[model samples]
Target: MPRPARTTPSRRALLGSAAVLSLALGGLAACSTSEETQAAAQSTAGGSSTYPLTLTSPFGETTLEEKPEKVAVVSSVDLDIALSLGVVPVISPLYGEAELDPWETTALEGLGESDLTTYDSTDGVDYEAIAAAAPDVILATSGWTLDEDYEQLSKIAPIVSFQGADGLTGMTWAERTAEAGKALDLAAKAQEVVDGVAAKFEAAAAAHPEFAGRTYTYAVIHPEQITYESYDGSDTSFFERLGFTLPAAASRFSAGNQAVSRENVDVLDADVLLVGYPFGDEGLLTRSALESDALFQQVPAVAGKHYAVVDDLVASPLAYPTPLSEVWVLDQLVPVLATAVAGS
Candidate 1:
């Protein structure tokens, strides 16, 4: 759901030179524009806006004394929520080297490329780079912000930590958006976005009565091992919201994920199975391998071909639940799931 905070060394090593250059250049740009932007942001932050907004997280409570204009977001999903609320963050984390994902490319229309600064948080929260932005408030709801990181960020501005079980991954997309709205003094707008997604789910269920009473599970196909990791919570919640039930066998694991070996693939058996794979040919090969496995073939979903293979790009937002991403996901995912159900 939320991006993991502890990025592996290989991932950190993959940071492109261009992203580094952008961060370097963005810092320089932020410095040159700080005085003017900060002045304007302060005026908005203090004027007519809700102040002393307090949000409680696992770490403790953080109260924003003013409405924030210069907001900095460490979590990648928060940026999307900010944009949807018409508040462009002064600084946001980059999704790897790319400034935006495919869905974001369309969602962020009319926003200037230069309006936002981007940084890499794969290794950890970039306190120094974030401090450079000089924000009035920091949104770290979706990032891996530890207690130590929270303490450091507090020195920069009023910061809202993740509002769920853990720092990085607990909050549902709706919860995170609502929290962001409260912090930004746009509670009504946030509710509207949440309502919109709820309505979409209702529409999907109404359109496909067959989806009702069906049991389904979404699993990740590990590239290295011939195993499936079934995820609960947000991933299952998506289906549950649409009137599907998660099988009890898969629901007992409250840790969000339950790993099942290939020989024990029945743990993932359900009326429908949605498999996610790494992007490209590797994903296809993995899907093929799973399909060809005799043990996997014994599962009802596999036997009936009542499964859909989703790529990483499409799976990320669905796996983690965000307002904009949820809407985008429904548009692209419903048809696939519907097809799987029809076959089943």
Candidate 2:
């Protein structure tokens, strides 16, 4: 049963940290020199410098008068992608602030650039702050969709909302990055970024052939019996991106573009399972249920102790697709998966 929607201090604090924590644990990573190396080696788009660029955004076609300089990215995910591409916009949302979020401090320490200004979303966005940055174009995403605030942002610059594009709609992190690349006129570069990550997964898979035939399943088991397991092909998820296969039973539940959950968690049967929970709260419920369930204990992964506790924000399709989330995935998840696969 879904937990009652009660707002306690603890609940509110957790809910607030959830977004920040997810940014840390999910796939947000600074653009590494290694990734840059791979990108440099990839085939380029040739000599297309500055021209009238028309980008297909979620809202509509955004025609750039001449290679967008002084851009404003309203989404943290978009901020990460833009930063990764080495193009810092005039204005971007702060991931976490110094007083409120220490994770942001550590995350940006080695990233080498820090000219961004924070926009407090608690009240409406400060249009004057954004205008002060002198952005000619604004890139807004999910939260701003249909919100009156976007209209105010639009008055300052041509705001292209990402909540509407088919390419970005419910896309995985990889797909989202590709879409962002298109917006930046870095389509070829985006393709290379994905190709490079996929290649790493392939190498890890090759090193750990045992996982080759292994079937994996994922879920978020919240307190009070809120269990969500993947239900389809689009649910292949980052685990699938990292070379795991979904069980046949769960294959039929694929939502095509989004991650859909099963009504009954008991239907989740696979060789391996990944459970997620919030950060500060003890993962007592998830741990206890998995440990106590006979069917869960009998799974191949459980018998072999192959099951892992993944951060929901890291694994969730909604959070991880942004450039911000990818960094987290690489740092926290990839290294562990690479080692596990290598040894297994």
Name the candidate that leads on TM-score: 1
> Global lDDT for candidate 2?
0.50
For model 2, the stretches where C-alpha displacement exceeds 4 angstroms are: 1-50, 55-62, 95-111, 141-149, 163-168, 172-175, 223-225, 252-266, 279-300, 312-319, 327-331, 334-344
Top of the candidates by lDDT: 1
Per-residue lDDT of model 2, residues 271-332, tens digit only = 66666654324433545655677766665665566567675434442333445444446556
Q: Report, for every candidate in turn, its global Cα lDDT versus the true structure.
A: 0.63, 0.50
How many steric clashes does model 1 contain? 0
For model 1, name the residue pairs that clash.
none
lDDT of 1 at 94: 52
Q: Give one digit per residue, the lDDT tens place, for model 1 in 214-282.
A: 988777654333323354443466777777887777655555345566677787878888887643243
